[model samples]
Target: MADQPPIPFHRGHFLFGSTFSLLRDSLGLLRQLQQQYGDQRVVRIKVGRRMITVLLKPEETKYVLQENNRNYGRGRSYKILREFLGDGLLTTDGDYWRRQRRLAQPAFHRQKLALLADTMIDEAVSWTSQLQRLDKTQPVDMSAALMEATLRIVTKTLFGSGLGDQTTRLSQALNDLNHIISQTVLNPLRLPNWVPTPANKSYINASGLVTDLITGIIRERRQSTGKHDDLLDMLLRATDEETGEGMTDAQLLSELVTLFTAGHETTAASMSWTLYLMATHPDVQARARAEALRTLGTRTRFSADDLRAMPYLTQIVNESLRLYPPAWAMSRLSLGPDQLGAYHLNADEGVLISPYLLHHDPASWPNPDQFDPNRFAPDRSADRHSYAFLPFGGGPRLCIGNQFALMEMVALLGQLLVTFELQPITSEPMLPRPLITLRSKQPIRLYLRDWPV
Candidate 1:
């Protein structure tokens, strides 16, 4: 065993190792890894007592995420999210995760989320209309705009009655949790969750506010005899086929928080990147707008059924995801010794898979640097490997809300393009920040100009 050649190590400070670089600019570090080590090499990243082997190729990702999926589980960073999401599907393992997946699976079924498309369209309309209140010449922070809009759609879809006026309060709480957790997980002196230090207090307070809000909604729903025909009702009615048991209040709250955070955050990030791509490529934007108008007719709001015919719009969205997958990197812990390519991995070792690297691999994607939506054109995509493009991930644990997000994006973009065209307002280039989710380090600024009918 000792005779096995050593995997390449990313050299760094003796004490901190790759810790600072990983937190500061993860995408850059990943690209550097890919450039220096190629796709298959097992690269070592150690800081303190922790070690992770970065896996950048698709086949290896397929092996861990699908082929022998049971041998791996969610990474350590997920512990921070468990503070907010509890033991929901995203953070659970073994039969528990499988059971939860079954219960929530029916809620996001194709026909069900399809019915919620009108709700998404209505929400988009309300948000788009608010643009009138802003000065057209002023640079709008589209990242915040889309984040707020998607967050509203996700909450409303689950609760039937949107966040309403509590939108600001809930949004701020979530924002605080996401940022605090991402930074806290890296802090060497981070206190325990139960501690009353300033940081701990803030996380607890924000988490409690979120908990109270969800609990109130659940209690209200339980008292009602009428059916809402929404995600919550589906969940409340779901029973374990094996035990005939239902999720407890504590369980339901965790799942609710998971759905609330994961459902909106990734979709919003994708939409932000999409807006930037559209602005930078005027021709693609104009053609996409024209196609959207042509298919949508004069209607201000489009339907889920309407999304089926818009091929170009799908390409645009697919391309954006290729360039900037919201869940840029995911981690899994190996349950046993295994062979990943030529490297042997021991039990309990952490593995990192970067979709950002796989999607841009020149072998799989031609001229990967260019923003060409045609790469997703039906005929062109037919020959590509399924794992090659993983914005929503793949395998049994693929994002349950993928279809919902795609439909929601279509509704938002379709409604938006019908009345407006997005134009880039900032001369600076956009940079990706790989936190809990990938986000722009700086605001993705743009001007929304209304177009004639």
Candidate 2:
């Protein structure tokens, strides 16, 4: 057999930077590559002296995410997740992932999620009320506030009552855990799980506390005669239609952790970015507010049904997601040799599909860098390819919580707009730091201008 031509590799100045610099400035580096090579260039990125191939194109993204999904499995990027999530849906591949997906699918059923609307709205309103109490003289970190709000909603929806004080501790622990995971990704030394470095120890302790909380919730729900139709209850009662097998306690715990982590963080970041965008782009904000008022009619609270009725609000959220997909890039390892474009992919070689690059491609989107919610209008969206806007990704392995996240955003946005007028505290651009999810490097500082109403 003839030897295949070597894939073009670009070695640049940034490749020699410190490991922390490479980790912290990853998005900037990616942007530079996009400019130099255009989308779909295979560049060699250095992470602590290790060179990893980075693929950035929509066609390649579709090939990796949809067409050859089974041939690829979640790669090294998810190793940090497996420690805490324990081979849950997001980190697992092959038959294990398939089985877990089947077991957890019913909990996120549309009808069940519809019931969660009130929980989402209540949490949003509660958080907004706290924000409103802040003195207008001071700036509020809307980023942190949004994170807390989304965390509360997901926690409540998953575990039901008695989480008031526990939620605060859990949120702080999770935040710390997220930071540790991001740091660990940059340092590639293989360390035993029980090594007990300060960061690792913290993660272990946090994981234990969270697991205990989830187990207690499950036990309490099982013992109670009162019916709570929330997700945890649904997960507990869910039986596989094919084999009638139920998820074991450990399986359920792992999934609960996955949902709490993946579900809340991404939704929080999306909503935070949406608010930041709204603060900076007042005109678009006005349109979103007008849409909410027209559909909701001065109501302080919105329901799932009301969210469904607000189409423009949905578009605004969709547009925000396109600009800053929470899960900005996804990675997979080819199980066998395959053809991707003109390049022949090899087994065990990693492939990455960055939604960040695809959604911002100038060809797919005009004035790609600009904030334009109108791009998501029915007429405009109809002209685009289906894979062009993959905030929750495409194909079977698409985020199971996609609908739930959308609902949470709509409910939260509806309440936020009606309660406080958001103003940017600083004009600095909210730069992306692509860790577990894409997050702003600094807190999204904003002034909570009181609504005249």
Best candidate per TM-score, number? Answer: 1
Specify the poorest-scoring 10-residue window by lDDT in model 1: 182-191
Off by over 4 Å in 1: 1-3
- What is the lDDT of every predicted structure here? 0.83, 0.80
TM-scores of the models, in the order given: 0.95, 0.93
Residue-level lDDT tens digits of model 2 in 198-260:
877887888888878888776676688877867888888888887999988888888888888
CA RMSD for every model? 1.8, 2.3
At residue 285, what lDDT does model 1 achieve?
A: 88
lDDT of 1 at 65: 88
Per-candidate total of colliding backbone pairs: 0, 1
